[model samples]
Target: MATNSTPKKPAADAPAEETAETVTKSAPARPARKSAPGPDVVGPALPAGAEPISVTLAHHHTIDGTDYPPSAKLLVSPDYAQRLRAQGYATPA
Candidate 1:
């Protein structure tokens, strides 16, 4: 007659086997942020003998993605200021 036997496990006092499990994790993605306008979008320089007019811009004046808060005062060229006034975006301060 033959007998079957099972392998024996390590003793409690024995060191445990070391395993090298490679678990790779990717970094989380970040959201895009809005950038401020550069010199290129500031428009051309003031013309000779031309002065900027002080006008209060309305809340809707967000042209070129620039922030112009409501009742904000700014100096702009005469032609541009006039246009803004006509469009109800600005008023003389």
Candidate 2:
């Protein structure tokens, strides 16, 4: 004679507990949100006694991988103008 050892039925309350555990395990994690900049958070401020500058920027046209310079005018702050000159960029005489 052979005998079977499997349980005939599971408790009715067992399914509810298993469902809660499954839901917790499958839950998605929430991402952290970044805060937006405030009204006071502007870009870098200019130093004291800094002056505005004005200059002409030569426009260039590219044709067949070659660049040809053209005439153009650019108005900028004096400090920025000096910086450009230091970087070897100057207006035409």
Candidate 3:
């Protein structure tokens, strides 16, 4: 008698079922990111019944080798942006 080292193939008549993890890309959903909560930034004022929202701020590196500090975001509202505009914060030409 001889031993068969060859593995037998799966039966074609059997039904196949995919598992939950296999159905997805095996990656979990991205979690929401939150900035550090502190009194570093003064919450800008908003109109009545309006709430403040967060906006990301990116520091720019100057070509002259000057660099700016990193800021996570600014708490801005419609009214606050308007006030900034009134202060000549308009985009440069």
Candidate 4:
């Protein structure tokens, strides 16, 4: 006797569940890291023929979920400063 039999799907009301191990295994990939920069660390690369200037930030700057506190100093040129601000990076004050 041939019969069509298929497994039933879980109910909509039932909350989807997964163990931490499986959750991490199937989680979305981590984002690629940007150039490392810090107060004691080297800042991002300079542009060709662009003059460098040290500027203080006025807002919290976050990169890849890593936050750079406001009022921190960064060495960046004027043009680069605008570009960074556009990207939600530290803005020169």
The TM-score of predicted model 1 comes to 0.48
- Each candidate's lDDT (Cα)? 0.63, 0.46, 0.49, 0.63
Local accuracy of candidate 4 as per-residue lDDT tens digits, 1-93: 987698788898996687787666665788764543665322456677767777666776654455566776776666767777676565535
Q: lDDT, candidate 3, residue 21?
A: 69
Each candidate structure's count of clashing pairs: 0, 5, 0, 0
Q: How far is candidate 4 from the true structure (C-alpha RMSD, Å)?
A: 9.5
Which candidate do you rate higher for lDDT, 1 or 3? 1
* Candidate 4 segments exceeding 4 Å error: 1-25, 28-36, 39-45, 63-66, 83-93
Candidate 3 Cα misplacement greater than 4 A, ranges: 1-43, 60-68, 81-93
Positional deviation of 21 in candidate 4, in angstroms?
9.9
Deviation in Å, model 3, residue 37 alpha carbon: 6.9
The order of the candidates by lDDT, greatest first, is: 4, 1, 3, 2
Candidate 3: residue 38 Cα off by (Å): 1.3
lDDT of 2 by residue, 6-74 (tens): 879977767455566566776567655433222221123445776444454444433223333444334
Give residue 2's error in model 4 in angstroms: 20
Candidate 1 vs candidate 3: which has greater TM-score? 1
Expressed as tens digits, the lDDT of each residue in 8-35 for candidate 1 is 8779898556545433555777644434
TM-score of 3: 0.29
lDDT of 3 by residue, 1-93 (tens): 999999999999986898786687666776654434543333455668876655443442121232223444455675654553465432211
